[model samples]
Target: MDDSKGKFGFFADARRLRSFLRQSWRSADASMRRGAVVMWCVGLMFTIFGVVGDVLETWWSSMPFLTNLLTSLTAFFFAVPVALLVLHDVSHRMTDRAGRRAAMAVLAQSMYRLEASVSALGPVEHSRHSPTGGPPLTTGSILEAARARFGRLQDLEGGNAEDIREATETLRTAIAQWKLDRLPDQFIEEVGRVDIEIARLRDAVRPRFLQSDLEWPLDRQLHSLAEMANDLIKRPEQWTIESYNEWCDVAERFSQDFDQKSEITLLEINAVFDLLRHVQAMHIRRTTFVQALHDFNLSARTALWELSSL
Candidate 1:
């Protein structure tokens, strides 16, 4: 009877130990989940706070009167929507991990439907006759196009020198006129100087309208332009009037030598011309868009300033 009692007691203790370990594990898991939630919330809060602070600071510095109003309006209009988005994303991620596939799918479908509806309601066709019709040009777009074309030119074997000169000249001219407020004034002035140099380089490379021009001078100018371009590429930020002038001189000399040696073909020249024209068109479009944005911002800023003063 004692043996039987001892066996029963041992069994009971084993059962109790098992229960205790299971409960402890569950409690630890719950604590970890709670900690993760808290950390996520803290991170989200900080992100929203930083975004709001930045917006307010920019507004205050650029348009003080609009700062409070804009901040409040944005908090209600933009911040609320953004916060909801973040919440939705966090909830979705959590639910997904917890094996809530159906809920995740439903949320995703709802978002897609909402996006489709909004897109359908917006204007589908742009007016061809409108001066501002078609997608507005942006700095990003222009730079992308330039980089692509430059890469293509670099790939060509024994490319027509005149065409290269024309293309480079076009780019130089466009950059000279580019006015990004974010860009320093010194950069702009330097770009303009480079533009002049490119033109000079082009003139030097072209076969003399009259044969009286010395070949050595042309060669020297072409060499100078090539060297200058290489230097500029190395330190694009150091773009100055002096550097540009030197490049133009080198480019002209190189072009003149190229013109003298190569069987002057119209095809290469035409291709180069076409590229230049495209560059010019892009420049005009970008300038117009930037100008429009600048004007709108200026007017808005002025109005806000006046109202604040009153």
Candidate 2:
């Protein structure tokens, strides 16, 4: 019985090997499939040759050539399984490489859309609605800008086949938070209150910031944000851990700029008080946007890297 079990082991091993080969063939691409088919056909032909050669040698015992042929035919038939395994391994490697590249490409596109949406928050001469002859909007008005930017952002084709829902939701939440934090209804009301104080103290008025001067520093801040956005879009390949850390630095700079006091040319102490508060609010929006973008970039980079493991 022990001898019989040992004798049958080779058959059991071959059966397991065949099952593995079938799974590999099923997973392989078109080129590998064709190669597999050809290998199997060759293997079958050699099997037939081995059988016939064996029969011929048995029938014609003097034919030594048939014995040699049968040996070679058996060897070739055995080689086919080995060839199929190698083909499957190569195909799997190629498929993995292609899938990684594809996932990265999708990630890049998503980053582009995200950066564009953030850039839209920067001071624009006109809103997207302006081209359509709707109400003219100012970039400084966070309410209008957020609405316009989010409108376009929400409609973007975000993420790829693998966990697209996760990617999309991450981006959407970041952008929506950016918008929600900046809706300037309260800021506008505060501005109204400050305007009343400015009216009460009309006699003590002096220019703290000329309209141009007020806009200039704010404009510089906007320019910095724009450059950051443009950099992210232009260099999607640089979305690595190092680059993400660098983005955190960039976000910090923007945040610091918000806190950094600008030289304000005072018109009236009371009037300027309200204006400064409004500017502070705008800065908060800018900082929030930058931070949100960094988060989105980080999330996306992590997601793309995880694909390598998969």
Q: Write the per-residue lDDT of candidate 2 for residues 245-271, one digit (tens) a residue.
A: 333343334324323333211222223
lDDT by residue (tens digit), candidate 1, 16-122:
76775444334344554465455556556655765776777753466666656655654455345334444555664565444333323332343344333223322
Best of the candidates, TM-score: 2
What is the lDDT, from 0 to 100, of the residue 239 in candidate 2?
33
Worst 10 residues of 1 by lDDT: 121-130
